[model samples]
Target: MAYHRRYSRPGTNRTPTCDKISEILGSADKLAGEYSFGGRADTLPPTPGLFVNGVGMILLPLVSEHAKKLIAKCRQSRDRPNMDMGKSWLQSDQVEMKNPSWQAGMEKLMKNIARGTGYMDIHFTACLTN
Candidate 1:
């Protein structure tokens, strides 16, 4: 008989927490590289211990902690239904047409068009036709 280990249930949906942690760590590594000696080969220290301590001890753990907190927050939000805001403009497929700023801009544009052309209504109708 063989023994196997299973961390999660067969049908449970598990979030890729390790992947998120890896991604955060990867980004921190990239930033460390960029800021350290401008990623130059000659400027790098002779000992690998410097990078190991600076990145492994400091950056990786910091980023991992932040990632875990963010993941927890996301899970919490996902577990609850959003009840704050009204329907998004994308969901409703509608926008406010009576905004004061929009009306003012339209009026200014109409004045400019009317000044350029002799008639405002005719030019506006022609623009709509086009």
Candidate 2:
């Protein structure tokens, strides 16, 4: 079976764990030839060594490891390999964000909250509630 893990702080879930995300991405990398995967979350397809039908998301314990890499991949043109990864994320609704600045701000806040101690529940308030 495919590994489905969530990397978050010991008792908090604000930022995404990038390292863990990277590991997951690496694992998923093993599966890049089996399934016709496509999207930001679809980093790698199931291959001979990788498992099939195994997919997951990273959004806790730490910032998403692939966050930067994914973003970089997203920014890449379609000519590049895996360049469409970002597009898949958007098509899959995994990234339901329209504004880049807004998303960046939210990511920054999540990182800060994850690092420090504060009631930073983004869902509770409409705006910054720290």
Candidate 3:
């Protein structure tokens, strides 16, 4: 999860703790991504590590200690996320977005994430079971 908003627009839900929108991106079993941007209710801007999935510039704790541990583990492991897989996944979505600005913004955001995480590519497919 990650969040870094100083102020929220009107009509949005207000929380006493913070006004940011915390996006918890995770798979069925574990969390996703190590972020250097948000880890607290009050992480200010100028965040160079403000991206979706990548090598984190610094571990600011996207969600919890688990995330930090996972990040460290992945870093140490020889296995790395497949860049092409993630790009394939996002290509269609980007086209669907239609708006040029939105598309560009998303690309930039993901690029930042990738850069920060040093290869935050993700393309997960799971078998379901109860």
Candidate 4:
């Protein structure tokens, strides 16, 4: 299973950055909303045998949507200083930072995208499995 999320500080971080998250969330929400997951929201104790690959393939559209959003969010704070957030957004993670100009929050956003893409690819493949 794969899940992806994006974050944006509309005013504190940067306009471009927040705009990117909005763009990605828009695409992902659209795809996720339109694509049926083949299970009800309250479907508990999922039947193990209900492994129809076709059902999983439904999330591919959303994966791409997520990646796009991730990249956009990562690139957003490339020009802002860490002080923009009034606190150090820096993190201990290496990939947590993308470009020099990217704020700490943006770095984390990039990492999220990288991680999300890997999951998306794996799930997408699982969906294609026959």
Residue pairs with backbone atoms closer than 3 Å in model 1 (clashes): none
List, residue by residue over 23-120, the lDDT tens digit for candidate 4: 77667643443232232322222222221121221122346754444334332233454544433222222122222433443444444444544433
lDDT of 1 by residue, 3-25 (tens): 12224457876569845655665
Which scores better on TM-score, 3 or 4?
Answer: 3
At residue 77, what lDDT does model 1 achieve? 30
In candidate 1, stretches whose alpha carbon ends up further than 4 angstroms from where it belongs are: 1-93, 97-99, 120-130
Residue 104 in model 1: shift from native, Å?
1.5
Relative to the true structure, candidate 1 reaches a TM of 0.20
Candidate ordering by TM-score (highest first):
3, 1, 4, 2
TM-score for candidate 4, please give it: 0.20
Model 4: CA > 4 A from native: 1-13, 33-36, 39-130
Q: Measure candidate 1: CA RMSD.
A: 28.7
Global lDDT for candidate 1? 0.37
* Candidate 4 positional error at 33, Å: 5.4
Give me the candidate number with maximum TM-score: 3
TM-score of each: 0.20, 0.18, 0.22, 0.20
| Candidate 3 positional error at 77, Å | 35
What is the C-alpha lDDT profile of model 3 across 38-117, one tens digit per residue?
33332223333423234233334456754554344332212335553221222111112223454445555656556555
* lDDT, residue 13, model 2: 61
- What does candidate 2's lDDT look like per residue over 70-114, in tens digits? 454333334554753444332233333233454455555454543
